[model samples]
Target: MKVEWKGVMPAVTTKFNEDDTLDLIMFAKNIRAQIDAGVHGIVLGGSLGEASTLLAEEKNVLIRETVQLSEGKIPVVMTIAEQATKVAIAAASDAHENGADALMILPPMRYKSTDIETVQYFKDIASSTDLPIMIYNNPVDYKIEVTVDMFEELLELDNITAVKESTRDIINIGRLRNRFGERLSILTGVDPLALESLFMGADGWVAGLVCAFPEETVAIYELAKAGRPKEATEIYRWFLPLLELDISPQLVQNIKLAEVATGIGTETVRKPRLNLSGDERKRVLKVIEEGLKTRPILPDYKSF
Candidate 1:
């Protein structure tokens, strides 16, 4: 299936059993819910999916399971968040082998690479796989910014086809559009900035909160893309508090907690990462509960 690299592609959280094993059953249920909610694609093993902590074998399971569950209903894209060029390339190959339709790759983690090194890292990975790539550009979190000029250098790679624009600098969206035009599909990576980015011509949203509130997320994207910004804004306003949770440092825990509240998945995370607790737990749950209590009626989004 050819992914258009457009619409609400949730950076889905990886569901795990209490023993820290991959819960394929609950994971499939989450993917099915997102598909039923009309998401354009599903991205696995991203930051939201806790890629940093997962073993390579675990990631393969996620990629394969997502592909099997999606069953061609939507594209299943796995993330490559490795710190080394060789590991990233190997991951791309493995994802392709496991039937991932595409990949969302971040710049090298841990050691910050210079502009040239960053470009080369992406080049090496792109050369290793035929699957389409979405350049995950969350400089705020990842600490390596893929500047517009750097992107100009990367334009030579054909498979490096899309950008997950999470710079938080809204101006960069226009800069990317003005520079790349249609050469790169620009998908907004920041949940709070989804409306603004789409309004400013972002091609789609690689959303975080969509994991829990899939329908609202897709509705916002559809409404905005269909030129119904007024209607979209109404929902965005109602959804902002829940959306803000995606930007937090504890986004994975927060989103998974929301998932538990919504009956889509569990809140169990791997070690070094604990479930939300005490005041933070109550605070986050209150926000999700309030939103659930007043969950806005979403418009019927027409799927492609």
Candidate 2:
């Protein structure tokens, strides 16, 4: 299947019951809600989904349920960020078989000596599947960062077609985009820089914030695509504070809270990846409350 990678692809949250099990029902509801709100794409098992916290089977189940819920209307993109190429390859195949439209692979995190294991890991998985792969290059959580040169080399693989650049450096993204041009679909993973990236010529956004605020994120992409920079800028400004929260240590928790606050999804998450508690959550919740008070022109998201 030729998956068109563009527009809003929320790094969706994996809903968990209070007992720490995957909440497939709430998760499917969230996916259906985003699709109804008009997001162009959906990334099932990314960082925001708490990939590290989920078991392999749990992630597999999440992909399967997401594919079932999407029901072929939007593309289902899942992450395979394991350090071992074999694991990554296996997950990619699972995603493909389970109905994912594309796979997003990131550089390995453990044993960061920058060995051939690093580059060849990507090569091994890229060659393992016919599914179109988009490399996710985020430097913060993962120790190894794929450089433009390294990524360009990986592009020699036929299946490697797109990338989700989740760094703050617009200059780096611009440089990569200028060099690769049409050969790569550059999607910014950070919501704060998403608008800037669109203007800088990125093809899409793989965002976590969009899970709760789909209307605003989609609007940002549309207005920018329609050449309405002023309107997009205003929208971006209104959500900038909330966008900052998406990158914090509390991102996964905060997104679910925002979703619950908006009555779209649950705030429940797994124990190892617990939701905010006590004082910290109180302070963070205050930001959401205050942001809600300041009216920003956005879509009226209906309860699903």
Strongest candidate by lDDT: 1
Compared with the true structure, all predictions reach lDDT values of 0.90, 0.81
Candidate 2 off by > 4 Å: 113-115, 299-304
What are the TM-scores, per candidate, against the unseen true structure?
A: 0.98, 0.93
- List, in order, the clash count of every candidate structure: 0, 0
Which residue pairs clash in candidate 2? none
Query: What does the lDDT read for residue 154 in candidate 2?
Result: 87
Candidate 1 structure quality by residue, lDDT tens digits, 262-296: 89989999878888889999999999999999998
Q: Which regions of candidate 1 deviate over 4 angstroms?
A: none
- Which consecutive 10 residues in model 2 have the weakest lDDT in total? 295-304
- RMSD for each model, in Å, please? 1.2, 2.7
